[model samples]
Target: MAETLRNTLKAERERLDLTQAALAERVGVSRKTINTVENGVFVPSTILALKLATALDRPVEALFQLDDSGVSPKQDT
Candidate 1:
């Protein structure tokens, strides 16, 4: 079984009226980094995730979650 990583970074960032570039600056990353994460092309590191959560005034869990939809049940032999 496999788990997926999901996030609400764009929504939260927008709620705070922040542009991707602005949020990136706040979190010490590049705008492309933020875009990548928002678009699910990249997974941020623990430090980056925490920094984003803090900058957006949200908890880390609120920003990211483990999605189990990708999990598959074991098949009997």
Candidate 2:
């Protein structure tokens, strides 16, 4: 069985030098929402995931992925 959502959200945000509040603002969500999502306490809806991908200029799969190997993909940039 594949794992549930795996997130590189915090890493991706940091790569862009963005704070949680900053990312939240871009995605129209609260900082706490970003925090929870980062900490794996919450799974974002598809819309929010797409918003994040758009704001970060990445494919949603890069930030949120599912893999049976339990391995996170390496950053392309």
Candidate 3:
């Protein structure tokens, strides 16, 4: 099984009525970085994740979760 990092970045940013650029500026990152992170194109480092959580006033776990749907059980040979 694989644990993928799924996030609620888009939803959280929207809930705060913040544009990608605005959120990026607040987190000292570029808008592309925010977009990539939100769209799951990029996996943010722990530092970036913490910064995002802090800027959004959300807990790290609230922003991200581990999804195990990427793999399936092994079949008997």
CA lDDT, every prediction?
0.93, 0.92, 0.93
For candidate 3, write residues 26-60 as lDDT tens digits. Answer: 99999999999998888899999999999999999
Would you list the rank order by TM-score, best first? 1, 3, 2
Q: How far is candidate 1 from the true structure (C-alpha RMSD, Å)?
A: 4.0
Inter-residue clash pairs, candidate 3: none
Report the C-alpha lDDT of model 2 over 1-77, residue by residue, as the tens digit: 54677799999999999999999999999999999999888989999999999999999999998645856679899
Better of 2 and 3 by lDDT: 3
Can you tell me which runs of candidate 3 are displaced by over 4 Å?
A: 70-77
**Order the candidates by lDDT, highest first — what do you get?**
3, 1, 2
Residue 69 C-alpha lDDT in model 1: 87
TM-score head-to-head 1 vs 3, winner: 1
- Per-residue lDDT tens digits for candidate 1, residues 5-69, read 89999999999999999999999999999999998889899999999999999999999997868
Each prediction's TM-score against the native? 0.86, 0.82, 0.84
- Among all candidates shown, the one with the greatest TM-score: 1
